[model samples]
Target: MGWLVGVVAVVALLGFYLTFTAKRVDRLHARAASAGRALDAQLVRRAATSAVLAEEHGEPDLYAAARGALDARVEDREAAENDLTRLLRKQELDSSEASDVAVIAASRRVALARQVHTDFVRDALAVRSRPLVRALRMTRRHGAPAYFDIDDPTLPSVTQVTSRATRD
Candidate 1:
């Protein structure tokens, strides 16, 4: 009788642990998804700001790249964003201009958002990769999280302009 009670207690504890782990996995996945959406929004904002700057500065190449990023399909998005970043890097943006300032601000936001998205995805992937979680298929319902690999969206102009302003 004692042995039977011990077995039941062990099984109950196992069940509780599995339930807790599964719930944790769910929460992490949700957070990752939210972060992805935020990152997408920031990327879009950056592209839009770049497009405006390109228009005002009469830069056809920059405008095209920005538009391409805004219109890119999911599979092509990273490349499109990279192209935009490259073009932005080549331009000598005047921080005094309102449009230029907006572009710089947007770029900063993109960098921050990307970092947050990367962290959340890393955490979710880590939890999902646990041996017991995999064996029990805790993440079966959610697709594996993927990192959005893009060029460093941080613009050199941003740092330079910020330092210049601070010194003034």
Candidate 2:
């Protein structure tokens, strides 16, 4: 009887542990999804802002580039975003101080959003990859979590842009 009781207790504890792990994985997946949506919104904002800035600056080439990328499909979005960032970094800002400041702020937001998204993705992946989680198939419904791979640009900080504007 004592041996039977010990066996039941062990089984109960294992069940509880598995349940806890499953719940944790679910929460992480939810967090990743929410972060992804926020990141997408920020990317759209960055692209739209860049397009407007390009048009306002009277750079037809830059405007066309930005517009093309802004309208690209999801499969090509990473490349388009990278292209847009590369162009923005290379092009000289011929606008007023206020305009330059606005662009810098938008770019900074994109950088921050990307960082947040990446962090959430990493968390989800870490949880999903745990030995117990995998053995018990905690992520079976969701399959495997994938990271958003992108060559995120290092845009100028607000201070750098402001100082350059002042110097110029």
Candidate 3:
């Protein structure tokens, strides 16, 4: 009788633990998805700001890169964004111009959003890779989170431009 009771208790505890782990995985996946959406929004804002700057400066290459990033399909997005960043880095913009200042600010926001999205995805992947999670298929319903690999969107000149703008 005692052995039977012990067996039942053990099973009950295991069930509770599995339930807790599954819920945690669900929450992490949800957070990762939310972060991805925020990152996308930041990227769009940065591209739009870049497009405006490109038009104002009469830069065709910059304008094309920015537009490509904004219109890119999912598979082509990273490349387009990388091209836009490369073009942005090559340009010298007057810090005093409102459009230029907006571009710098947008780039900074993209950097921050990308970092946040990366962290969430990492966490979700870690939890989803646990032995118990895989064995029980806890993440079977959730799609695996993918990291967005792109060039660092923040320009090195941002600090200099920002400081100069602030001093003016």
Pairs in steric clash, model 2: none
Which of the two, 1 or 2, has more TM-score? Answer: 1
> How close is each model in CA RMSD to the real structure?
3.8, 3.8, 3.9
Tens-digit per-residue lDDT, 104-129, candidate 2: 67777778877888888899999987
**lDDT tens digits, residue span 1-168, model 1:** 999999999999999999999999999999999999999999999999999999999999999999999999999999999999999989887777888888888998999999999999999999988999999999999998899999888875533345666888
- Model 3 global lDDT (CA atoms, 0 to 1): 0.91
Deviating ranges (above 4 Å) for candidate 2? 1-5, 94-96, 157-168
lDDT, residue 136, candidate 1: 91
TM-score of each candidate? 0.88, 0.81, 0.88
User: Given candidate 2, what's the lDDT at residue 89?
Assistant: 86
Model 3 weakest 10-residue run by lDDT:
156-165
Best by lDDT: 1
Model 1 residue 62 CA deviation in Å: 0.6
Can you give the lDDT of residue 26 in candidate 3? 98
